[model samples]
Target: MAPFEPAALPELLPLFYRRLFPHGPYGRWLGYGGVVKNYFQLREFSFTLRDDIYVRFQSFSSPQELERELQKLNPYKIDIGAVYSHRPQEKELVFDIDMTDYDDVRMCCSSADICSKCWTLMTIAVRIIDRALVEDLGVRHRLWVYSGRRGVHCWVCDDVVRKWSPALRAAAVEYLTLVKGGAETVKKVNLSEPIHPFIRRSVGVVEKYFEAYALVGQDILGSPESWEKVLALVPEEHREVLQDEFPKKRDSMQRWELLKGRMERTRRQGTAGKSAPCYADWEIMLQFCFPRLDINVSKGLGHLLKSPFSVHPKTGRISVPLDLQRLEQFDPFAVPTISSLCEELDAAGDDAEQEEGGELEPKRRARGRRAWRPTCGSLSSLWRRWNVHGEESCGGGVTCKETSEASLPPTALFLLRGHCWPQASWCLGTRRLQPNPSAPLNPFPPFGPFLHKKH
Candidate 1:
């Protein structure tokens, strides 16, 4: 199939927002019960227009007002900033992560380009942060969204998390950070053990993926140059000995085996007590595999992240949610573009194409609304699973089942998994979302604790 055309976004976005946008769920998500004065109205939105013009501090009193403004401007991109005390210019706490900052560790694409090869790094990062957010800091409502490009954004919206001061956010980022030093530093991960439980869990997560990601995918020991770099992580004395012996080994896998065996034999011979410290092969691997987070992004309380479901102007793809259940299976290429969704709407037949005639706004909305239902027909099983009753489309209603204490957040799971969207869909039962219980299929099964957060 052919790829998306960025040039068509200006024409498609208006109609996309008018008919296909999940304004109801989005309104419900932001308004969040109007916890403060006009919560939805107090939240900030940034619009990226054609020619890269950026407009910020725009808020609406209600979802309807927001939808009208969106249809009017047809912004190329939408960024959601933190909810504020007053004018959104004063940003608040909203922790996020940018994948580009990890370029130093990844051998794959740099800046905005991403492929399945480096995407695994994101999985590791998510695993690390997701666990810590729950286990370490006690956050419950964490919403992770794909950046529509190379990274992911984590929104820790637990009311308790929201109230955290900027200092606490900075402290939290500092706590999660481990692989330190810059490009100039050779030994980034220093494991003197008695490691924190958080890092220990992170290391376990890396162990699960290292062979596939590093030994096979990255080929960190594939050549003499790469081997020498891995060797640099060892002490200078041990490095010389390993350099002499590793060449006799063949390929990355064999070389890695030899490196580890050499370290063990030496330590057993008590050579580890000699002048320099010897890092276990696992330590070297952990250094190579640990998540390289963007410290500033998480540390700063004022950072704005692209709203979940925002269309990337350049790629024309929707910045959807990440499916934590099938995270390893989440494919960036599978995300539906705004143009593609519009095309699906078009394929519903020209009766819809012609519905744009000078009919009253409500009449056209009705016609447009009916035309788009086929695109959403795939979501039936999901709705059925959630036990969503009533099928209503907003020509202009701003709601989703009037969320209750017992009900899941209207957009929670859909945003959690990243693809299911009407976007007003919600989980009706009291069951909480659990982490994937399946094993990783390697030496160890997928081993993280299952998470079940109630909304």
Candidate 2:
């Protein structure tokens, strides 16, 4: 295969869309019941073409049309946008977050460069928001996708959420936002006596990572150069006192303790003074630790976000679905590029074909024999490859179709990269759906055939 570079996208995208895209599940997810006429058409698709030319308001009548168009344009990036009232200009509610916005707290990597140390910020963000979305709002069905770059985007697609009004969306954003104030304001987060339950919950999340993330990983107080940045968060005479005490401390851990002690003394001194903000040590930590969301993205109803499975042109990586259970261990660097995935599919196909040629017809028909396909592997083998627990790849907790947190491994994708593209079918469970024998031979009309549901 040619080097998987930006230059290779025009050549690679068509093959990926036509041969490798998981159309059956993808269509099933978007269509829901296919009851809402033009439900799929109501969706907005945006594409980033070569030379960074972006095209918007692109809608497809059917998943087949979407497949055909994708093959034709071979776009570099694809974004999913709000379902609209008329044209895509009139959009529905949506939310998005970027890691770049959290640059103030993240020290390991800046801008597009992200290491595992800073990656934990994203993990924290997802957990906090996922909990609130489920517990507070009573939402169901959310899809989380890796941004294919420096961050992650969560698509809150619960049936009621998509229909939420702009006012309700704005209220939701306001409820989630903390660490307010701009560059001019020294104190971003302020906590009063008896912090609110929402803030208390946030503090619980922050304390979990404070030492590993802030003190050790960032070493925010390791030097006069760095400690001053943190000291600035403190007010007046106390800042100078901590500055004097911090250097004597051996590491960030001890320095943080000193900082906490100072805050405690100030709190004891009381709210009698107007100048000092009645701030807890936890408030500063929350400011530094909490996920900084892109308020405008979630605030606007018309906002668009990058679609999952879209190839990030810069990295040559696809935006795959994230598996939440293994989020702490999720590494963006491991995701496969278009070229790599294709190469894997090709190699797996060669191996399967070789095995088929060598086997006798009787043996080939055995239940264990993997059915050969160009890209999609046999359903039986797919089930075996996805065996994470006693359960198949699919987990009960996830809202997305992914059976795991990581992208489809080449072993799984190549195991069942379907030959029929969008029409691919799999018998996911035990026992085939008995189509009336009197009915057409193709019980599953839209998908190719009735799958043998395994026990």
Candidate 3:
């Protein structure tokens, strides 16, 4: 497209409103050129009557060029939602975040390239909206699109949400911003439980992206086995090569390093401003670095921050510092186990009904009972055993039972409770007596609430 001045809102206001704000009662005017310039120069808008307006601009032209041309007009942050059809006679409010430090070029480039970092931030913004309006408040809404060249416009349609006051919007934004910060903290905390729910959801998506890129990396690396594993993790559309042709040849790590060096050189020499070109060039460089491996560096370290592993501040290496017990709270695997157990219980009921109806019944239950097998002894017993054994073996030469002394004392009778029989047996000796299945697992004293006592 030929360079043309951006349309003046005064002359083109009707057209702008028709095209961009069809349903609004009134629209805000954004003057792009000398009208804005002369307004500042003359300290009044009255002088703008005759100033020549520059309307056409190069899409790729730097913001510096635009700044040089328009002395009075810097890029203004426009909230599309605030635009109206007819000027509301009522008090009007606007929701806008301070954009003082934001660089327009960076913003434009990031949006244009769909930069991973920028994409993450934008997606997080969407998620905040989703969580606040949909999940928290139980408001049902659909996001509408604005085909803004540089940035997205999300139109919130829920009547209840649309009526939200400016103060409410601001509060929601603040809460969302806090959640964003908490998402970042996941990198430091390494404990997933502390992460805000919205952040956890976003991080899960980002992790899947990483896994996809890693698969691509493996494919490029020529490690067929690793590539297959990675491929299996991703969608079929993401796999670029046939399963049989995946590279089997392995190259030395140094060769890959050399290839990366060459790729970096190419990236630097290439037009650095073009995001797509940069991404493409980087991919090419990766291919050269590890012809056999598919390294997805495009997504970058943003994914690493989302993982439940903390990166060391100085070394920049990731480590798992959160205890396993804490990790289980937010773990998807563990959460589903409860539901699976419920399903199993339902199945068991069906089995009981079949038995009563004289239908053939299986010897053992199809649904397995829940159990806990102790992996190690309690702190007290471990300490005592260490004392008895010193640095060497214990003099008694007795086999160390894996049971926790805290759960079952030496003098306590082994009572098989619901599912605790097999689970508790690891800690309790196999010499334990089998009590009636209907009897209480714990009769009294130390057993207390932990075991079932016969009435």
Compose the digit string of candidate 2's lDDT tens values, residues 203-259.
Answer: 787778788988888887888888777877776667777867876889989988987
Candidate 3 local lDDT, 1-455, one digit each (tens): 11113333233222221211111101001111222232112111111112333222112133233223222332111112121224211111121211111122122232234333223233323333444545665644332121122122232333344445555655554444321222222111112223466544534433333322332332334355434433342224334533433443344233334434443454467555332112222222222111110111111111111111111122222121111112112111111111222233344345445544544434322211111112222222232332222211121223224323223322121211111221123122345422234433322111112212222
Best by TM-score: 2
Write one digit per residue (lDDT tens) for candidate 1, span 234-283.
Answer: 87667787788777877788888877777666555563454433446757
Q: Which stretches of candidate 2 lie over 4 Å from their true place?
A: 1-3, 87-93, 264-280, 359-369, 372-455
- Worst-scoring 10-residue span by lDDT in model 2: 443-452
Clashing pairs in 2: 323-405, 375-417, 376-416, 376-417, 376-418, 377-415, 377-416, 377-417, 430-454, 431-453
lDDT of model 2 at residue 11? 74
lDDT of each: 0.63, 0.63, 0.27
TM-score of 3: 0.27
Cα lDDT of candidate 2 equals: 0.63
- Residue 271, candidate 1: C-alpha displacement in angstroms: 11
Give the least accurate 10-residue stretch of model 1, judged by summed lDDT: 444-453
User: For model 3, where is the 10-residue window of minimal lDDT?
Assistant: 21-30
Cα deviation of 190, candidate 1, in Å:
1.7
